[model samples]
Target: MEPIGHQTGRLAAFDSLRSNVAGTLYEAGDPGYAELATPWNVAVRTSPAAVLEAATADDVVQAVRFAAANGLAVAVQATGHGIASDLDGALLVHTRQLAGCTVDPGGWARTGAGVTWKTVLAACADHGLAGLCGSSPGVSVAGYTSGGGIGPVARTFGAASDRVRSFDVVTGDGRLRHVTAKSEPDLFWGLRGGKSSLGIITTTEFSLLPLPYIYAGALFFGTDSVADVTAAWSQWCPTLPPEATTSLGLMQLPPMPGVPEPLAGKFTVAVRYVYTGNADDGARWLAPMRAAGAPLIDAVQTMPYSMIGLVHSDPEDAMPASEASCLLTDFSADAAETLVGAVGPETGSPQLLVEVRQFGGALSAEPEIASALCHRDAAFGLYSVGVAAPPELPAVADHAAGVQSAMNAWQFGASLPNFSAGGGAAGFAASYTPDVLARLSGLAAHYDPDSLFRLGQVPAR
Candidate 1:
């Protein structure tokens, strides 16, 4: 997609950007421009006319103002883990150089747009604190929170955006503003779940969980019990209390060194659990899942909070990926059967991992104020992920979508922001209800009257 036919003359502003920022300015001829513009998903081919590596928040302000003055659009990217569309011809603000992190032992931390979850997790661990990290800690914190971060502990703690204290953003009008619940209320509410359609977030502050250690990990089961174990887990999860968070995954892992001996080169079922309460209670809560089937690996145990990656152990390497997410009100008996029958062990599923996380607990409760995030009352979150570059990967993504559509009768109102991909305006709009979208639209109009930040995931005016 080109720049909507309005990128006529931005030479003067682009010249100013090249002269002001300490970071490198990459144009069409730059060697690294192509690689840097591409996203982790790889499906969308981002082709920014010029890429500005923002060394500080001021650079972001300059970039936005330059885009506005020159009639060019603006887009933001950190790790590219969540890009939904090609940033074609937009002035891409690369936040990688704005890396800054400060952890306070008082159970909170402030970070720059370029900071990733892994860095925050390590910093918080030093003070016996924990940041609400997703399955893969490599994703950027600002990007994750901008999408209402639904992670492993989502059921217990709710969305990561709920803990946000403030956001330092560069509005499309070329202004740097500090936004919070009390200041710029609409922007504050919209930014929490609106992604990047409204403005460019340069820094954010969020509260941390007081979890220094947790009884969390996954228990892998062989294919023979995949159906039985999955059905059992499905029934068992609804009865879990607020302290216990759980999800089940159907995986077709290829034989690889990092993969355990029993799991690789075959299909398997993994019952992942995270108990934020006492260790003894966590163990008691996991007993049913442990007894569900003969396990290949039982890695669930009390471990340091920083070791939370053991629960899912999502791939760390960059690769082409395709993903989809939906909310389910409840997985009834019929729904459970439908899910298992469609993707059961004997079905020869091609997905790398098909996961269903039991939601409720804190997730069902609303934040103190209204926000753009929708479908909080859904009973579960169904997500599908598969490699997209390999020859067989297309089939895998299709099968995963099939499994998801099989449960469409129970599909909730919208998709979760974290799991949405390349949705563009329609996709981002799906994450919110009509009212929330309206409010976000109003804020976008007020702050970005020129409509510069309309790439993906931001509600349209």
Candidate 2:
């Protein structure tokens, strides 16, 4: 892995790129090699031939052009929160330094690709507004939006991509372009769900809703109540109005400092909530779920939108993680029984968390604009996460696969881009319909005839 030496003819072109871009370019032996190549998902080791810490949009264009000219592929990452593949000879463009954000109180915000959800949330908070953010605010806004972000409020507000107004991107073509519903409609449609497969998103402009406060948080129940609570939630969610969105989690929390005393080192059930309506009505709506089981901690309460993270507190630190997810068409009583029998509290599931987010209402409604995002009709999404490469990893991944297999009867559509790994091109195809995938491939070919951005999950032409 010595810095792609002179023996390779591409070195000369790579060297020229190093001289032109304002960014720092590092090869295999560089001091930053270890740090730049490391991703948030530490399971897959990334071994890019060169790393470019792009300082400006121009630098991104230059890097793509160089990679294209030198017969090298390109891959882009900001926080590396959702890396799906290991980068081998691909030139990795680290977008962490492209930070910039602007909040237009009228209704929207524009952010650089590197900007995280917290940045937009804070800026929108100044205007008593909120962006459609994920469980954790640490995820990059563009990356999250591009992957059709689904969160606690997804059933109420729909995917983050649905709220997007525009995107500034560097396509695989080595050209920078602006994309939106009206201009470059095909690119706009593809970028909304196509993600980095088509290009590296430089910046994204999206709508922010007027949500000052919300009735949101999680209600924790003990292991004794897991069966009762999960069963009730499965039936109850289908009846929920559009204003309320919810998810249920089966968690086995370590007895760490942040762990609530009652839930420490125990298998517990948590019903996460997010209500975008009147507080009193929201409470009344949640009564059925609250009455499902005697909650260990009745933490759900009305709070400012800024505190929404309390509902589904994703980890703040980067760790080695492997996840599997799929959209479900139904969670019938029989399915629920099967799930509980397999991975419920008594079974001692190995993963850190098993979650099912109810999807319908606004999420099922098609966006006004035609975009590549598909599978809106799915009723729910199931996901599992655990440490990768740990001693128990093999068993954990196996158990997760078993859980997935058990739910096959309820699985309606493909896995989400943000949650799926393996299957590569097939995974991308599964995320959308055949027509949408074909359209995306056409756009990619038109924008990037050279196909420099084909390192990971790009649509096959």
Model 2 TM-score, all chains together: 0.96
lDDT of 1 by residue, 316-431 (tens): 77677767778898877777778778877778766678888888899889988667778888898888777756566667767777887888888886887777764456667788
Which portions of model 1 miss their true places by more than 4 Å?
A: 1-13, 390-397, 457-460
TM-score for each predicted model, relative to the true structure: 0.94, 0.96
lDDT of each: 0.83, 0.84
Clashing pairs in 2: none
Q: Which stretches of candidate 2 lie over 4 Å from their true place?
A: 1-12, 388-391
Clash number by candidate, in order: 1, 0
Best by lDDT: 2
Q: Report the lDDT of model 2 for residue 33.
A: 77
* Per-residue lDDT of 192 in model 1: 87
